[model samples]
Target: MMQNHEEHDHHENGSELSEMQLRVRALETVLAEKGYIDPAAIDVIIEAYETKVGPHNGARVVAKAWSDPVFKQALLANASEAIVALGLMNRVGDHLIAVENTPRQHNMIVCTLCSCYPWEVLGLPPVWYKSAPYRSRAVNDPRGVLADFGVALPADTAIRVWDSTAETRFMVLPMRPAGTEGWSEERLATLVTRDSMVGTGLPKNPKDA
Candidate 1:
């Protein structure tokens, strides 16, 4: 009975969101399939939303992980369980693995076959994420791909690519920005962006936010 009640509540709370996601996904898919959009234009739109607008739930998750060490440990250990346990997601379809950005390594996500995204946290995948060139280049030429996104990592930082399959998706836990010490989770979430969680960009510096 409790499980059924939870399902009922989840559907009531999230049905509209799910529907809109479907509509948006359908529209973007149709446009991309018809060759009506340019990949560069798509990148610009994503940039405009950086820090200013984004998947709030994902940002919140990122902030919580940043502020809480125990939670971060669990999140890095098992993203699907951690997110669901936090009440941020009712379920995680398939497996959701999380990779963290560190001084020695930067993690990026790609779905070479298709756009297998963690819609529960990050919302719909961006157009650039689904493009053919991005899928091919993210693995073969990661540095060049980051350059196109205007991201310049340190020469010593190794870029690690996590490929998403139909049954497994991934998210990036970006390094917390400096000058954010003692900041509230709410304040820190403002620094998280969709691209940062995807690994194409970094969280907003505290000053920038």
Candidate 2:
């Protein structure tokens, strides 16, 4: 069976894409053609950097914080400044906040109004993050939302949901897992996941990684 000319170029398979995503794809196609880049490679590049598909920058921050106490303190006190020092600042937002998770408490972020995220750290916000259901449920039933992501916190640990505004954005600094005590920052960063910083998942255990 031979594919039609139109079908050969079409990527969507009866799936609906938001107008923004569609526009991004259009722009991506134009740029790739102009630069003589492969279209498939474009998707991988966008997923790794443009979209919130990877923990490239935030993983470094989380890993460093886990290894360096002084840096951790500075990051907690002023996220925007700390990341800027590491040259990770990329116009994420007007303000950036780092929230730490502890044995007694967990922090989750949500933009009830819109998706205001630390793009440089976490890449862009995920589609789900911008959805009405997530924006509403994240605040109303944070534990349930975490559960949906397969993260079950201890009953004793309190869950705190932070609402992100256009002027401010928040990122979760998940507690380091045990058995990773002596891990190097590079190795530890491999354990950090995009969802962990988003507050919906935990870093991978050393054994798992």
Candidate 3:
């Protein structure tokens, strides 16, 4: 009787959310009812992702690499170690590889099998990133995928897609825009967007940002 009541309540409350969100809500409801988890703790975790450990961490890392040649070298050679040097290590991100977006080539990150993301750096994966369409199209139609994101690369530029896995994740080091020579790391960090870091979009133009 209680289970039926819970299921009814779940359906009543879940009409507006996506299927995945509904399922997660239902699971959370069950766990909370059984005393296995606290809903307040879940709220805290979501708050931390929203306000505390977010894209700013990744932006700092990107800015540091942009300003420091040695750090850039280290990042390209061993991303996991480089990020750890900046103290951004976390449980979900055991191994991370950094890819550079150069003039001739671009890089994009995706997890085709699942939504395996670098949460330590990126905080939380965006909703579209976990959607089925993106997962299927990121590898199969990267150019179109990028176009949909409003990133129009030159026809000559080659696109490289990296698949994220449970053991290894990837981050993109976007090319620094021109006309920003001698800029402070703080200023550069502000120009780094989460989408740019994800390789779905480009960094904001200095003038526009």
List where candidate 1 sits over 4 angstroms from the true fold. 1-56, 112-115
Among these predictions, the greatest TM-score belongs to 3
Estimate, for each residue in 36-119, the C-alpha lDDT of model 2 and write its tens digit: 778878646755755544334899999999999999999999988888787765444557899999998888887643336676
RMSD of each: 10.6, 12.3, 11.8
- Candidate 1 per-residue lDDT, tens place, 88-115, comes to 6688756888899999888888863333
Per-residue accuracy of model 3 over 1-209 as CA lDDT, tens digit each: 00111211111222234489679989999999999999989867875665355434888889899999999999999887887877755433667889999988888888642335776787677767877899778877889999999888988888887776556788999999997899999999999988998999988899997
Worst 10 residues of 1 by lDDT: 1-10
In candidate 3, position 159 carries an lDDT of: 84
Whole-structure CA lDDT of model 3: 0.78
Clash-forming residue pairs, model 2: none
Backbone clashes in each candidate structure, one number apiece? 0, 0, 0
| Model 1 clashing residue pairs (backbone) | none
Q: After superposition, how far is residue 118 of candidate 2 from its true place, in Å?
A: 0.9
